[model samples]
Target: MPIPPVILAGIARMGMTPAALIWGGDTHQELLCGYIAAILMAFSSIASYLPQMKETGKLGFAAVFITAAGNIIISGQQYGIWAYGAYAKEGLFVDITGMLVGIGMMLGTILLAFVTFRAKVFPLWNVLLFVVMLVSFGVPGLESWFALFWGLAYGAMGFTIVSGKYRNKEAAAANSLNLAS
Candidate 1:
């Protein structure tokens, strides 16, 4: 049997809590938590994509894949920084790469949000909250508070998914059809 979408989405959304802990301090433990958060975010992207796939198609898949890839890169960078102080201080190339990847991931996330909104697999309120959090990333003073906003947005989404507030009838029908064949 396939795992429920709620479980996947819920776990992915709640996983951001650890990532939020990065703001607690720059300790090695915090960095490791951030690394784990990246991995969870990667899986979350994949989880978020599943329900929307039938409606969003290849564009959605591309966005999810890019987001997942970006998360993986971020995870690796976090690990490198945590493991080697010299690497963090001297590796200009890694820093540049991480910045570029982060920007790419942000763009991919915007695209995914748009696609997901259009597909209507998730609730409008949750999507709007997510978009607002993303937009907050660009606001001068609000940038520092992004992690908190992100945690709230994803946490809301996770709760909604777990509570069965959002349903994808098309995906369900498709799954039933596939199972019968």
Candidate 2:
């Protein structure tokens, strides 16, 4: 999520458009970072969903799946761009696909967050913060800042999960066992 904007900042510093940046042959690191971020997002989405699942049940499960699918698509797209920059240049399909996936991912994330919020599994403040940061994506002047805040919001939720701040220890333990097997 944050990777693209950071890369865009680098592109701006270099006075290059996004397409030009993709064609520059020096975007390996940026592409790799974006791919890794997508993978991490997928895993974290699953991790956070574990607690919410206890309260939200199958709705939480569905939301996480949607979020995971979006991330997987994003990672695959990044891989394609890294492997075949020429194909990206041939048409608007690549760009359009990226934009659509981004929108879908954003909506999926919002739904998951809302579901979690209703579950009351995580702290209300944290969940609200996460939702607000995500909503900022649509604000024109805050687009760049959203990346940073969204990362912080997501990181806070990750920290909450890791710190065992959720309400149900038994469910979490059982879920961990189920995940392992």
Candidate 3:
């Protein structure tokens, strides 16, 4: 594939935090980038769940997708709060609701990663990067790292799908079994 959809969407996520930093000067940039990130996040979440829905179960699919929605909601809420807060020249941050939402996002991601890893839907690297992404949230200095790692994880998954490595291996194994039988 020329450029995998996951890579593209991952790039969008990678842009989110930087976009937020530069968003201070104008609402347009912030709104534009933030919306793009949210849209991609939504798409990736769904894409991620599709394969799992079969190999793993619908419940895992639903969990991640729902949590991804929660993530989107949190993003939108933060953007608004930060934007307006900036406009007012206040250093204020999240409220109780936002905090709860943030926790929901983190918890959902961690849970999905665990489930997906256990299901072997994706490789362990994908799950590990997701855990890294989850951990990055707690460290302000590591804030940008989360998206970078996420982008890498998604890009890797995309490459794996496009290259047919895993699929072909499975096919080859099944063929061997068939011959033996």
lDDT by residue (tens digit), candidate 1, 18-115: 54455444347656655766776777766566656677788889888898898788888877878885557466788798788978888887888888
The residue pairs that clash in candidate 3, if any, are none
lDDT of 2 by residue, 1-181 (tens): 2433322322222231232345443266556655665666766677778766667788788888887788788878877877786575456887787788888887777877788778776777667776677777777876445545555566666666667676556665666677778
Higher-scoring candidate on TM-score, 1 or 3: 1
The per-residue C-alpha lDDT of model 2 at residue 145 equals 52
Q: What is the lDDT of residue 97 in candidate 3?
A: 60
- List per-candidate RMSD values in Å: 4.0, 7.1, 6.1
In candidate 1, the residue pairs with backbone N, CA or C atoms under 3 Å apart (3 or more residues apart, or in different chains) clash, namely: none
Candidate 1 stretches greater than 4 Å from native: 1-25, 167-181
Q: Pick the candidate with the highest lDDT.
A: 1
Using all chains and alpha carbons, the TM-scores for the candidates as numbered come to: 0.76, 0.70, 0.69
Q: Model 3, range 67-148, lDDT digits (tens) per residue? A: 7787577567647644675553333454566667667776777777777776675667767777777777677877545666
Of candidates 3 and 2, the better by lDDT: 2
Clashing residue pair totals per candidate (backbone < 3 A)? 0, 0, 0
The candidate with the higher lDDT, 1 or 2, is 1
What is the lDDT of every predicted structure here? 0.67, 0.65, 0.62
In model 3, how large is the Cα lDDT of residue 133?
76
Question: On TM-score, who's better, 1 or 2?
Answer: 1
